[model samples]
Target: MYELKIALRQILSRKKQTLFAILAVALAVAVITVMMAMLSGFQDELVRSSIENNPHIVISPQDEGEEFIHLYRYTSALIAKKEGVIAVSPKYLGQAALEYRDNAEGVSLQGVNPESEENVMRVNKDVIEGDLLTLVHTKYGILLGDRLAENLEVHIGDLSLIHISEPTRLRRISY
Candidate 1:
């Protein structure tokens, strides 16, 4: 008690120094509080954006060197039967080149069952130009990204050629 009293007396006697010290501590606390709030807001936004853009879970082939998932239909059906599964859309991804007139651009092609993809991704909500339901009836229908469509100078009814190369063979398909 005596030591604390002596310390208090010293601080009280140096009024200007004590006031400056108090202000410095207050400024540090305010800056730290503001930085913490900003960090929390940033983290929350990052998590929300990641959740919105990605699937809850992704299932891929277990083998590190495997290029494709074998028996994907059976696997997908089994996964769908598990608890808490709302939908399953199996996709086959390939690299292809799109050719329209003289323009050619390489792109990644994804083959998906349109109805199943719609159930899983709600893709129809983002369709701006054509009916996604057309894919159900159109035997050779394809959906392209806006940037790809723009780059290829293609419109709704225009035909485009796709060339795909595989290890065993190369195939060209027109749509």
Candidate 2:
């Protein structure tokens, strides 16, 4: 068409300006490509870390009114029977205050069946002092995270007082 020829002539006439515009578009596209790659890389790394650090599947209560222990007991069996599950461990999680002689910090307390816990989560190897499996049947025995232990200024055998929030009231348990 005559219009196509005229447009081509116009672009050819302003060579420097056309080149600059093309370069700008190329630079913008390159930036967008790099940003997209970085975002995808970040997402992949996050998913990999989560998969490596946590369980493949977590079976939790579906409703707020159900007790966590009830959910754990029921789900443990169901998980054990599931096709892809290698092992199952009952989990009990509660919020408590970690206390030492003078220092205290509120922490999330988790009770796990250690013999089967290895199948679910990779235990941190740098834990300095306590046996991870020692709390299997030990009621009132609490395992503290490294940071939490440091905050409370306590060692493994040292006692800690825990204050928990119940449905209707607060209760204190010494560990």
Candidate 3:
């Protein structure tokens, strides 16, 4: 009790020192609080962006030389039957060039069944223009990346010729 009284007396004697000490502590707490809020917000944004942009799992051909997955329909069906599997989408990738009017741009082409893709990827959510259902009736239809479409000067409903050259096959698609 005697020591506590002395300490209190000492603190009260130095009024300016006590004020500065309290201010410093309060400022530190305020700064820390603001920093924590900012860091939490940044972390949430990063997680949301990752979830929105990336797939939960990606299955690729085991052999690097293999261009296509064999019996993809059977594989997709098998995967869909597995526990915790919600949907499956089989895709084929190739390199192609899109030509529209005078503009031409090389693009990586991805072919996917509209129904399966919608079930797995929810592609309709990301579409900015035109319905994904358009591909169902349109033979040899394609969806281009935004940058590729911009480079080729093409828009929805516009016709673009796609030339795909592979070691085994060469094909052209018009849409």
Candidate 4:
């Protein structure tokens, strides 16, 4: 009891110093709390946005060198038969360079069924100039993303040549 009283008296003698020390600690704690809350909210929003923008589940081939067609077909069937599956669409992705006269821009070539792709992806809504559904029955027609189209300087109805190097080089004119 005597020691407690002495300690209290010492603390009271340096009241201003104790208050400033307490205020500094409080300021640090408040800043940290605000930073944590903001970081948590930002992280949650980022994750939610990424999930919303991308596919719920992605089906890819197990082996990289193996034929993706067979894997995609089998997976599509299984996905279609699954209980919670809303839709299933097969895709063939390849990298290529878009060339028109002197302009050359690297791009990704995505082979997808336009009719079926609508149910699987939000790409239909993302088409800025051309209708994605138009490519359903058209074999030579390719739907380009806005950024891709801008890089190539090609219009909706304009034609562009895609030069793909898949083991060997292949060129195809796409509208």
* Best-fitting candidate, scored by lDDT: 1
Which regions of candidate 1 fall more than 4 Å away from where they truly are?
1-46, 166-175
Q: By summed lDDT, which 10 consecutive residues of candidate 1 come out lowest?
A: 166-175
lDDT of 3 by residue, 83-109 (tens): 999888898888877787798787787
lDDT for position 93 in model 1: 79
lDDT of each: 0.79, 0.70, 0.78, 0.75
Off by over 4 Å in 2: 1-47, 69-71, 124-126, 166-175
- The candidates, ranked best first by lDDT, are 1, 3, 4, 2
Better of 2 and 3 by TM-score: 3
| Model 2 C-alpha lDDT per residue in residues 57-86, reported as the tens digit of each score | 666677887657465666678768978778
lDDT of 4 by residue, 61-168 (tens): 777886475756776888799898888888888788877556788877788888778887767676766677877656677776666666766666666677776433
- Candidate 1 lDDT: 0.79
TM-scores for all candidates: the values are: 0.66, 0.61, 0.72, 0.66
Which has the greatest TM-score? Answer: 3
Colliding residue pairs in candidate 3? none
lDDT of 1 by residue, 50-107 (tens): 8765667778778977867999999999999999999998987788887777878998
User: How many Å off is the CA of 96 in candidate 1?
Assistant: 0.9
In candidate 4, which residue ranges exceed 4 Å CA deviation?
1-42, 165-175
